[model samples]
Target: MRIGITLTDSRGPDALTRLRDELADAAANGMQSAWLSNIFGLDALTALAVAGSQVPGIEVGTAVVPTFPRHPVTLAQQALTTALAVSGRLTLGIGLSHRIVIEDMLGYSFDRPLRHLSDYLDALLPLLDGEPVDVRRETVRAVAGLTTPRVGRVPVLVAALGPKMLRLAGARVDGTVLWMTGVSTVRDHVMPTLQTAASEAGRPPARVVAMLPVAVTDDTEAARERAAREFEVYGTLPSYRAMLDREGVTGPADIALIGDEKSVRARIEEFGDAGVTDFVAAAFSGPDAARTRALLGELATAA
Candidate 1:
């Protein structure tokens, strides 16, 4: 599997600089890709555009940019622009987010997310391919075309977990970018459902990019405790909770790759064995951060 790392979640005045250095270091270390999340702080696509402009060796992507807030046309435009800025190396990962965040926080309904994704892709894909779009589905409508130069076709991946979402992703887009999901879940549920749909649709094999917290340490219990504390919110989220249940794990910490170097390396290999195309490590080892990074770099080089 191709190995990658997430950008540091550093905020404030030096966040951009820190991310730029991280990207450069990853490329220099032979990492295949670097992923950025679109959460609260800086916009992920814009940040990647700026940071990625200087480092053109490794691929850059968003773990996800939510589709609710931005129109399909607008997002296509932005993604294309960012792709151009980054030397045609942008994989646009998008998702429905969650009902709590969409309704309570953003004041947008999260109803019928599968249908929304289908409609959103219908509009967004064509625009990204430099074609005219005139689709008007129930959840999305785009009747415009972009004049931007083609920076190759921007590959799209959806953050999918449930069956419907996976089927839609396999049929409509390139693949799925997963988080809080384990190897067993990917092997039993994700691969079967996604690959079948892609095959039925006459598409090529789907890509599965798995993102999980990783730590390299001998103190297993301490690392597990730290992961439990740092990533508690994911255990409560319904979609992630469902995957945790499917993996037959109690919480987020159970799926995390935490242990000594050998154990952690073995766990990472398990994901590749289960058909993961790429493994993006979200290292959260605190004091062991540098050690964890060194391991990831070594693994990336080996991969």
Candidate 2:
């Protein structure tokens, strides 16, 4: 399985420099990729574009960018531009963000998210493939196409959790990107459902990219406490809640990869055994932040 680290950036001029240095460090430590999240921070695509200029020998991508705030045409344009600047090392992970951030916070009607995603990708995919898009859907319409200087292949992964989204991702996109979902859920629910859909559609095996909070520490209880405090909001999100319940986990901490080095490495191997294509280690906040990253680096080399 491919190993990577998740990056959450604070906004500033120094962010790009920090990302460049981080990518260099990751490459030096034998890591293969860096995943960035677009959760209320600098634009993920643009940030990656700038950082990719300074780094080499490692891939970079957005863990997820919300689909509601931007139109499909605009996104295609931006993604293509970023892909060009980054020399085609861009994995675009997208999703319909939750109601709390979309409706309550941004004041946009979080209406028919599944339908919106269905429409959104219909336009977004073809355009990214350097095809002329003329889609006419209920939630999205596009009559755009990329000009010259197109990317060869931009692998797209959807942040899909439920069965419907999994089916859609299996049928339409490269694979699925998961968060907070456990090994049992992936083995029983996600992998089976997605692969069945892929079989029906005559597609290749669907990619399962599982992003989990990870730490190498002796104080497992303290790690859980910190993970719970830092990621409590995810526990309240409805989609994440369903996955947690499926895993019989009451909170995010329960699903975290926190333990000593031996235990952490074993946890990562567990995900690989459960059929994860890529295991992206989210640098979970704790007393051993650097230790966690160092372990992830070592594991990447070992893998």
> Whole-model Cα lDDT per candidate?
0.92, 0.88
Q: Indicate the residue-level lDDT of 130 in model 1.
A: 91
After superposition, the stretches of candidate 2 with alpha carbons farther than 4 Å from their true spots are none
Point to the candidate with the largest TM-score. 1
Once model 2 is optimally superposed onto the true structure by TM-score, how far is the C-alpha of residue 135 displaced, in angstroms?
1.2
TM-score, candidate number 2:
0.97
| Each prediction's TM-score versus the true structure | 0.98, 0.97
- Write the residue-wise lDDT of candidate 1 on 1-303 in tens digits: 999999976788998999999899889888899999998877999999999998988999999999999999999999999999999999999998988898899998887888888899999999999999999899987899899877698999999999999999999899999999999999999999999999999999999999999999877888899999999999999999999999999999999999878888999999999999999999885678877888898999898
- Expressed as tens digits, the lDDT of each residue in 1-303 for candidate 2 is 989988767668798888778777777878788888898877899888888877876788887999999998888888888888888888899988799999999887887999999999999988888899888898888887778467678889999999999999999898999999999999999999888898899999988899989989888889889999998999999999999999999999999999988989988998899989899998867778888888888888888
User: What are the per-model numbers of colliding residue pairs?
Assistant: 0, 0
In candidate 1, residue 122 scores what lDDT? 92
